[model samples]
Target chain A: MNELSTLANRLAEKGKESGNGFPFEVNPIPGEVEVLQIVIEDREELPIFISVSEEQILCMSYLFKQDEIKSGKENEINKAMLIANISMPLSAFSLIDDQYVIYGSLSVNSSLDDITHEIEILSDNILESIEAMREYLN
Target chain B: MSLITKILTALRGGAREVGESIVDKNSIRIFEQEIKDAQGQIDKAKRDLTEVMAKEMQAARKVENIQADIIKHEDYVGKALADNNETLALEIAEKIGVLQAEADIQQKAQASFENHTNRLKGMIKKTTKALADMERQFIMVKTTDSVQKATAAITDNYASGSSKLLTAKESLDRIKEKQADLEDRLSAGEILQDEFDGTDDLDEKMKAAGIIEGDSKAQDILAKLKAKQG
Candidate 1:
């Protein structure tokens, strides 16, 4: 779809802009979707990633492994996760098979500004959740 | 029947009997060779399947690419016709037709590859599953044979006076007793330890300071002893 490619090209341009504080690189995965790896410079972990499809833009990033947490800290961390989930606007915190990851999506109909806003805040959701659980996370 | 024809039929029957005997003798070897040949064919089919899958992917991409080009070109054609550029519009329409035909050919190729790959996949799956079943059955038989031998060996060991089964339980009990003894020593041995604690001894300090005296309980007064002597 032209809309999809136009969106990809726009993202590619955004990825090149200096001092945008949202540095990203385009990774072409053939026949499926276009993936953009966005850097969250302040947080030292895996890069935040976004995927483009014909219908929507998907964003996600991994926070930590679930198994590394001890059972004693589960109750405290779970309480914080619940609160973060309720307070965040578009992103939702989800546990994915021994790893904690946050993810969100926006419709392609949204303007580029709206898409960028969702992506930047999707990463913020992960950072804030991690910072809140600093007592157990760090 | 005539005598010569009957003789010929008898000779033919004898030859058939000899051939049948030879075939019976080598049936197992012949069957094994056939199985090996079938396996080679299956391996070839699997290899060809990967090639077909690759072609399918390329063909599918080719179709999508041309389809996108056609859409773009058609939009241009519409614009040209709106601008009254008859020559450009006709040229663009011709190009669009070419792209459409090419896309159709690629779609056919994609379909052909899909069918070929699916057939090969089914064949390979069937052959692989049969081979796996055969291997499983062989392993089951071999396991049964080994298990019977092991059972016999165990029976013989128990029947003879040489078996260590009786002593194993006694050794376990001995180990438990030793463990219990070690645990008791661990608990009570703390009090019997002769090493002095690192802290200063209050009683020894008091005696050295003359607040208490050697060979005299605190109740025995030094003043009474002095009075008696005087």
Candidate 2:
């Protein structure tokens, strides 16, 4: 019924047309924005979460769990994250509790192409960081 | 040869050695020429790669076109045989046979060109990678050689003039002596900082921590009110 719902529907339609085969579902959240979850391929059960608002659209993928992040390797993890952030196209790294997430956002004025590109970039950055994190972490 | 001529030759040799140490022109020239040669090679390789790729593309297109022509002719041969013109059909069949032979030859040529192009691509990639590595090494060595030559010139000049330059140890000793004197002067300056003037240390510390004498507009307003009342 709102602008974000319209946008979300269009985004899902575009995904269908694009034939990327990412299983996507949209769920409404109370008083803020609807969430769109995409099952990221090759990431083993960790899904990319999407939230859309009037100001910006955000995509986040929970990359590593607390136990998956090796103990006493915060320094190496931070350094690798910093470099990956620098090299990533449209995605940035963020921390939530003990979870490592690749977060990407764009202004609401962005076209469908831009949103697709940002999501693609975020997914690629997440996949690439997994290898480096393995070496850096225990 | 006369003794004077021999002496002159020795002096020229010594002068050349000095020039070599100062400029090292010969080595620099050699390096420049080598880099130029490498650049020329890469350029030629690039040009050849383009030509080879163009040729491969042409051959591939030729094969595709011939394939289409062969299919069309086979259909025509069928139609001609159905139309009951046996002689014309035989003639068409012969032409088709000739076309198939030409097509087979072109297909072979296409395969050959593809292999040749792939080999050339691999070779160019290797040569380019080697040249890149060589360039990096050359830059490092050239920079190091320049630094070494400059240092040598300075040390040589110092050797002919000062006792400190007699050996590296003496030069280091001289440097240390100067450093010590500079540090002594600095320490004298530092000694003044150690002397304390008597003051209310607690007051200053409290002020620094913003726990004493808050600057507020409330105080100014209160003063203004009292003055107005008076």
Candidate 3:
């Protein structure tokens, strides 16, 4: 299997052992470098995707599309997210194509526990981040 | 140009054309090529480092050989002086002087070579580290590019279909709902626990009011004795 798939397996096992009440389901996306979609229980709407590179392990989730924002509030919302980015812990905000994404990255050498912690933190951040930007949504 | 500027330029090129990814595969390919070029340069520097080191060793050997010649000639001068041959001793001393001059030249060359070798080695070491750092950055850029493309594809699919894509507001709403649900569950549990604890208190109150029997163990023993007596 690919690097992401292997990481997904490790994360799945970690979820079982942690018993922090949030369960995980990992699904692999076939490609040149495999991507894994990790759906955390109770936070299924914001599923985190894991993308592995040779040097970085990236965990990201999509927030909303640009068109979903109020028409005139695009620039305003961008500034808001940029302002919120600094205060948000462990994750940052970016616009990929047309969708806004929140992501956290670690070195490829990071342990399974660190990766799992990153995922959990990202999952939590997804909600708070979206809520912070809720005023701009349509 | 700086890496950030290069990346931004590539992204700008892709953005001009609609339907193309902002950081398309071509840009990533270019980045990968750049990383490969950096790797090639580091490899060449390593090769050059070895050549410089080899020259340094040669220069050092030449110095050592010149010093040995001067030492051997000094012995000859001493032997000639011991035979009481003044003319022969003077000639040998002159040869020793030539050897010393040659040794000076070789020693200078060896020191220069040593300095150059050290400088080259330091440059190669620094360049190799920088190349590794660039390669790592390239990988991250490539991964982010690929992730963007994948996310775009998924978003497009969802946009074109009847199934609405989940919005930020909706996600936040769901989170709130889950939190509310958890809160409700916790409160319910607390209520249940309170009732459990309150049951003992209620029973004690009832016994005090004589509405329910209390401490019936002694009464049961007395009844058993009465039955035995009868």
Candidate 4:
């Protein structure tokens, strides 16, 4: 198996055995690249997708769709995202295929604890980001 | 064209029939190809380095052999001189001159090999760093591509689709509702606690009706005593 597939399996196991208060629900997305859909309990609305590449492990959560932005608010929302990107801890705002996503990148050699911590922060950031962007969202 | 330029061009010209996917496929292929090419270059450079290193070792060995021969010949010249054999000593000294010249040539060759090795080492180092940078950037691009594809596989429209992922609007609505409900529940708890405290209510009613004097201020009481005495 590839490094990503192995990491996916380890993350799933960690999600099950972790007693660190952050419970995760991991589901593998079948595709060319090993992608895992992870949902943190209580923050079920936002699901984070994790994929490991040659040098990095990326964790991303969909923030909103471009069409979901309030009409005529794209410029303002885009600016807000750009500004917030600086202060957002460990995550950045990106537009991918008309979807706005918040993603964080970690080294492939990051420990499981580091990955889990990143997930927890990412989950919190997703909710907080949505809340912050609520005024501009439809 | 550059990858960014190609992607931008595709985006601008209208991707009529899943053109975005086609662009993605092409770009991913390009990245893979580029990465492979870099790897191949690194491999070839390492091979070249090895060859250079091997030559350096050979030159070093040759220089060492020549130096050893020169030292042995010098000893022979010394023995001839000690025996008062001037002709023999002169002949041995001449042989030493030839060996020294050979040693000097080999030493120059060894120095040239050393310079080549250093250059190759520097080149390899630079190439390796560049390769690492390219790989890191590829990771970012590849991960983003995979994420976009995975999301697309589930549903084109996340809000109306059956996917578990919720749009930020819906999530924010739910969060607001939950917050409002929490506020309501907390206020209700306070009201219920007040209603359950029967004696507190009785005390308030008594104070209002003057059936029980409300806790009098010390200043008020003192003033009342002074007025009565006066």
- lDDT agreement with native, every candidate: 0.63, 0.62, 0.77, 0.77
Report per-candidate DockQ: 0.01, 0.01, 0.45, 0.30
Fnat per candidate, as a fraction, reads 0.00, 0.00, 0.38, 0.36
Model 2 lDDT tens row, B1-230: 64346434543454443324322458668867787787788788778878878888888888888888889888988999899988888988888898889888888887887888888778778878877776665654453343333333333432354432223223234445665886898887777555432235666677678787646648978999999999
Q: What is candidate 1's lDDT per residue for B50-141, written digit by digit as tens?
A: 99999999999999999999999999999999999999999999999999999999999999999999999999999888766654444333
Clashing pairs in 3: none
Tens digit per residue, CA lDDT, model 3, A1-138: 356667778787877766567678887765544677787877777788877766577788888888989989999999999988989889999876566889998888999878888988999898887877888898
How much DockQ does model 2 earn?
0.01
User: What is the Cα-based lDDT of residue B165 in candidate 2?
Assistant: 24
For residues A1-138, what per-residue lDDT tens digits would candidate 1 score against the true structure?
Answer: 456567767877776679887766544332223345555433323345565543456666656656545568887887778777878889987653344667787775788778777767876666566656656642
Model 3 chain B poorest ten-residue lDDT run: B155-164
lDDT of 4 by residue, A59-116 (tens): 8888888888999999999999899998989999987667788999898899988998
Leading candidate by TM-score = 3
Candidate number with the higher TM-score (1 or 3): 3
Q: Which candidate is the best by DockQ?
A: 3
Residue A42 of model 1: what lDDT?
34
TM-score of chain A of each: 0.76, 0.80, 0.94, 0.94
Q: What is the lDDT of residue B199 in candidate 3?
A: 98
Model 2 reproduced share of reference interface contacts: 0.00
Error of 4 at B113 (Å): 2.4
Model 2 interface RMSD, one decimal: 31.4
- Rank order (by lDDT, best first): 3, 4, 1, 2
